[model samples]
Target: MHGPGSSGWLLVTLCAATGAYCLLRMRSSVEEQRRAAAGEALMGFGMAAMAVPTAVFTPPAWAWPLWAAVFGAAGVHGLWAARASARHLHHVVGAGAMVYMAVVMAAGPRAAHHSTTAGIPALTAALLLYFTAYVLVTGARLVPVPAVAGGPGSTGPRTGPGAGWGDRPELARACRLSMGIAMVAMLLTM
Candidate 1:
């Protein structure tokens, strides 16, 4: 990201750590979680790589198109997976956003800087709004909500003593939230 030295490094650290956690989540006994974790891990790592400060290491011109191609395949995979569960739709959007950023950076100097532009592209603004809402909704879900007594569909917290590290839904939600925040930051830089 085009941030100050410290902030850019912070984003890098945050994303890398998130990617590591997602890798651990892949050990989940649940097949579904294992699958989801694989995709999230890709997003986390990709964001980390892209967020590296330009001054420290600007990728070669060819790297941008290669980046776009990788994410394009990821988006396609996400689209196919979404058929099984709607949750995978988020992955599709995430991959698409990464592709968009890669393409913009490859377009030329002016598009890459973005600040020289008169206004944000409608697509970028739309992506920002989507990610912002995603972050808010995911964060809200993380809050502990009290269970009402004798409520029709009331189920207390889902945590269980036997649940493995990879099986914890809260941690997964947290992982998603972090990625959403990272996406927003990346878009702002674009």
Candidate 2:
């Protein structure tokens, strides 16, 4: 935790803004869409909580352990949910990272210890690398790549309730990008 002018405050602001957006999107979505976007909403809230400025609100003694348990269970469920598609794998990884971070916060000697080998904390370094690659890969996939002409391909861009901006897929991508940026900012702060 730090003052309003500090990096911690900046992180808190960014994460809160993103989380609010996600919640807004969820509220605006229909039942089916809501079901599909549940994971994204969770991600948004999770990131916001993780980035919260400590000075503004100190978590209860049980908070970190509880969060670890919740996210760890979510991660395991995500693995089972990902059996049919690789898409949900990211959720598993993100949830796992959250669990790891919560566990570290709950038990590690953060204030008195520094990394013996590298200046960066081992967990932070690993998470930074993972999220960096994830963001790059996801962004690349989102780029508009032209498909083969008339080769079992349909007409142009989709247009409907679940199409274009504000759709579940788009919102999920936005959430992912925001979380990746937040993770980078957190690592830098550490």
Candidate 3:
């Protein structure tokens, strides 16, 4: 079977690694954080699968509706999650977009991708824009900000991770930025 090229495989690797990290984060001490990590892990894996080169493994006929239903359910859950914490709105939008992309690729008139068309191109443009912005914003956040001293809200600078792999929140944010970059590249190839 045909397979992904070097760049495609690189994106796949990045996404898969992100998913793995998120899964590991599920073991965090905090229950709420664990739940959020679980959701992110699922999204990471799903996006990795979606990024796979179509030539390698075209999504099966049943995959369209199946993924639609799955993402739709995730979207609903994301909405509820957002109600509790506005941060989850991104998750809701991401899930909904996954469902939309799945449908467009599977059932649109230009499904074969024989020619430039409206559906996939438009969707890709939107995703690219969103992910490009996500990458930039998250990348900026990765920069260390010095904490204020003696300030009411200041916790002071965080000490480096000691024995563990890395800080969970920071790692998660890095993963998100990585995936955002990967998605932008993958979508461009469409």
Candidate 4:
């Protein structure tokens, strides 16, 4: 029973933790420039904007402006994806779902994420689905990470910021596992 008065701290916590993991991966080992940039940006935005719309925790009406900003960013992301030259299907679809959620969050005629109406939960579920896919694909594709910079055996991408498996490989897998957990939470809450 998704009831009122339950603070959104759980969602907030999961988002923040996963977001940190992604940011760390981006800063420490991501070789692909575009991937690093996009990953970090999404990490920040997704983490910060996750908790909203609970009864006791309803944001100030003033937050409508912030929600407006959120909607704008998500909307533009969707727009660029639409015009993208060689796009990753995941990003395109993810951004589109977020664009819709941002709209709903901002122009809400009072929508609960877990309401029986299903629309809001459906959108949240879609976002979770996309992120889950990203986690799986990225996690599997992460190359052999290295130990120290010039350890006896260095199996790291020479181009990225650092050469260490401690942060890189673990971060990718962590992102996948954590995001998978978040997906389950989203489904339950929704």
Number of the top lDDT candidate:
1
Which of candidates 1 and 3 reaches a greater TM-score?
Answer: 1
For model 3, how does the per-residue alpha-carbon lDDT over 1-190 read when each residue is reduced to its tens digit? 1135666666777878888998888876667777777877887888778777766777787887888888999999999988889998888877877787677667743552533455455656777788789889999999987666876638643555432343456777887787677666756655
lDDT of 1: 0.89
lDDT, candidate 1, 1-190, per-residue tens: 4577777888999899999999999988788899899999999999999888888998899998998999999999999998888988999999999999999988976875665255887788899999999999999999987667788538654556547877888999999999999999999887
lDDT score of residue 31 within candidate 4: 55
Better of 3 and 4 by TM-score: 3
TM-score of 2: 0.75
Write candidate 4's Cα lDDT for 68-128 as tens digits. 5664565566556556544444444544544454455555546644444755465566666
**Residue-level error in angstroms, candidate 3, position 8:** 1.9
Q: Each candidate's TM vs. the true structure?
A: 0.90, 0.75, 0.80, 0.54
Error of model 3, residue 176, in angstroms: 1.2
- The candidate maximizing TM-score is 1
Model 2: per-residue Cα lDDT over 124-159, one tens digit each: 778778888877887776676677888544476557
Query: What is the TM-score ranking, best to worst?
Result: 1, 3, 2, 4
lDDT order, best first, reads 1, 3, 2, 4
What is candidate 3's CA lDDT for residue 121? 58
Runs with alpha carbons beyond 4 Å of true place in candidate 1? 113-118, 149-162
In model 1, pairs of residues that clash are none
Among all windows of 10 consecutive residues in model 1, the one with the lowest summed lDDT is: 153-162
